[model samples]
Target: MGKNTQDGTPGSWFKITIPCGGKYDKTWLVNSIQNHCSVPFTPVDFHYVKNQARFFVQDAGIASALKDVSYKICDEENQKISIFVNPSNVPYSVRYKLEPEEMEQLKLTMNKRYDVFQQALDLQRLRFDPDLVDHDIDIILNRRNCMAATLQIIEENFRELLSLNLSNNKLYGLDGLSDIIQMVPTVKILNLSNNELNLVWELNKIKGLNLEELWLEGNPLCDTFPDQSTYISAIKDCFPKLLRLDGQELSPPVTVDIDTPYLIKPCKESYKGSETLKSLVLQFLQEYYLTYDSGDRQGLLGAYHHEACFSLTIPFNPEDLAPSSLCEYSKESRNMKKLKDPYLWVQLLKHTKRDIVCALGVLPKTQHDLSSFVVDMWFQTEMMLCFSVNGVFKEVEGRSQGSVRAFTRTFIVTPASNSSICIVNDELFVRDATPSETQNAFSIQVPTPISSSMSILSQEQQEMVQSFSTQSGMKLEWSQKCLQDNEWNYTRAGQVFTMLKNEGKIPEEAFKQIP
Candidate 1:
């Protein structure tokens, strides 16, 4: 029924169990590989033992240290799908040509897997034979057409897979889909727009996607995509801000609407926030969010200074506002058009409290329009959405997709603590896609609605603040300080800020001045 792989190692020797109990053994694994292997699948005679599940595979430099491999089943976009070989080590090669017969076998295998995955996805409506997928599968050929009858089997079985693909297939109905999509972290691309999908949650797991694109034009989500802007928001959690939506490069002036309602009239006039000291607030927001000990720290400083007057420095609470100045969208600006911006301020408040620890009302997110950056923002204390081109912008250069060098940023409020707030800023300059390198970008958070003075402090702590402030010519508002310019030139002045904050020499109030 089957033989060993080219290396004479075990392949089909592995066990596969789908949700509906379609158990496949090593024979099946060998049959699929042997049948489909195209030009890339080099032939190397090897030895194997089916009973012991042991095999010695010869190497044509195809793969190495591969302990085992198999297909894994998973539910994606309301259909059961099959992912190819589960490997233990890094695959030796990615591009592999497929023989004509092998391609046919690949289709059959995927269709069978799709059927089982569907059964598990729609357990309530369709219940068919279970699956038989085992071991870790690496590749997932999701683009080919699967027979309609095979889809029925997936409704009964759920085989957790690494990569799931159903690019162009015959499938209908997209219910019971949230959990399956969430579980897949290695998914590359998914094309399910032609299928029927009504709920937004099915594709809400955008944060965890390792995906390059999602081809979703024909789904129900498109009609409601505009309304569910918050849920479908494209957050720059782990990818570039310049996204390719359906193969088209997303342009500037992007916006998203977070579902929270922030128009509640403040107990006091919004200007009450203006009472907060200016130098103190600016210093806190600027330094706290600026990247520390990084290349862009200086550039970040330049961003705040070169743009501060031109920039609308909206704080999280009333203190960030001017006590005397009336809060109004008085005039359009050189940098941004402000309509009482809320996102930037919230980030400032949250970081200040982290330094304070027990201070409540330190941060609160709000709903507002900041036309300057071309953004519509709504947020909770810890979350935000930039509802149009305003919040995102990009410039790129590349010869190809893999060689393309592009950059983008997504702004949000990380007001959970002082670190959260400041970290958001530092993260902006720091390379998100890589460990090294700096970026030119920034984001803001809203302030807390309710707050109180620090209760976690001892009298000694107050004394420390008093002593430090007295020592410095200026008030010791935040724990961080400029790295004497020299340090920033050599390293980063902001890096000194992080150190000082950890030492507790600076006061929590200083977070409002991070720049």
Candidate 2:
């Protein structure tokens, strides 16, 4: 057959021309293609001759991986065999043997509004227009006794399909849904109501879809839900950006902040700090993550002070979601949530190199995506700086699960010497990311500028300020003001302010502050 065959008959089952004289096991070679397929769908069956092997798929949808692509088949010896697919031959299921006239009649029955074609080329042949299908497409193939054949057609012709109405159809299971969605990732609104599907489990099949609206009210699956709320939550969990489901609009998720807004902002650029300070902070983090990601916790011992404290907390789903006892770090983890007292936490996680190394040993090895790093820096004092780095990290060892999680590490660094700094405190927080975020985790992000501004302090720091105020008999505001002016030195602030008062330069109104 010619390279560009448009007769609509699928060519022979996908054949891989292997190098001659190599006695290869056929069964093992063909089975690997299913796993190698981009979507990783199962094939109907596969067979092999002496020097060639072929995979038979039930429909074109299952073989979507083989279409318009060159697939490599590797043998036990690490030898590679390249398989090239025929570009023009349509590979629909054998059961869907409909002629051009019948497809046109089916399209007419569905209505002229929807663009239902037998194949993508049918648009050019029948309607004499191919470019018109570039934008959004609305297709209706409901109640026409459609099966894999119909879905294959949709997959073949899929353009920027915005809405698809397959309602009141005999469509049973959504075996080809993933392939069709993969073909047309632009589909945002889908109506599969009045169908025979009984389970909503297929929703998981379309994990990375950007579907905005989905209508499945009349399906048998609707009755399976215990309540409307349960159904909505399950659907939303699968597709986080889903705005409307079964005609009911879901309320957008709210981002609640327990900490005051001043402590955190939407982006690092919002954190007011100088460019020079930000650059230094970024440089430190870039190097820090390089060591940390390589599964060498002991290597980072120098990054921390001998008295440094490191605690980790993991939030489930949203930030407000109560954290699981053991976060994604490992199956069994003694996270910060389990520690009841500060002394116990410190004792368990001793502020020493050996202790930190032992503590991190239990966690899974990880590789952080440095490009996604968002650093926000604030100068607590001339010698001490506080910064938080939020980015995505993937597990590299142990479970080696293909999931990327968002992690936030806040470090309090003080100058150990004139040229270097050591971490006094390191607070780490982890959370499961939304599907959309994880999908685009590797996408390039504009580096957010970091800076410092006046903001709230931690409870420990607040208590220290209060202690200084009580001992000095100065108002809390004046005491904090003096301490900040003296670079957070408790003893120096008292002496400096006293000297200022003795010199008659101290302002009287500074001491008389509001509570």
Q: Which segments of candidate 2 are over 4 A away from where they belong?
A: 1-92, 115-158, 255-271, 274-515
lDDT of each: 0.29, 0.55
* Model 1: per-residue Cα lDDT over 28-135, one tens digit each: 433444454432342211112222222222343333223222232222233332322232221121112333344344344445545343321211111121231222
Worst 10 residues of 2 by lDDT: 119-128
Error (Å) of candidate 2 at residue 7 is 9.7
Best by TM-score: 2
Give one digit per residue, the lDDT tens place, for model 2 in 1-515.
01232333555344333343124433344455545666654443122333454434434554556553343666667766565443233333333345554455444433444554421112211222222233222222221223343555555545656777656655555544544554677778777777777776656545557888888877788888665655665566567677888897665432211222232223354555455455556656755665565544444545666567766666433355554533444332235565557665555544554355455655667767555677777545655778888888767655546567888888887665424556788777777767876866543222232232123766766786789877766656666666665447565456555544664555555454546
User: What lDDT score is found at residue 367 in candidate 1?
Assistant: 14
What's the distance in Å from true for residue 472, model 2?
45
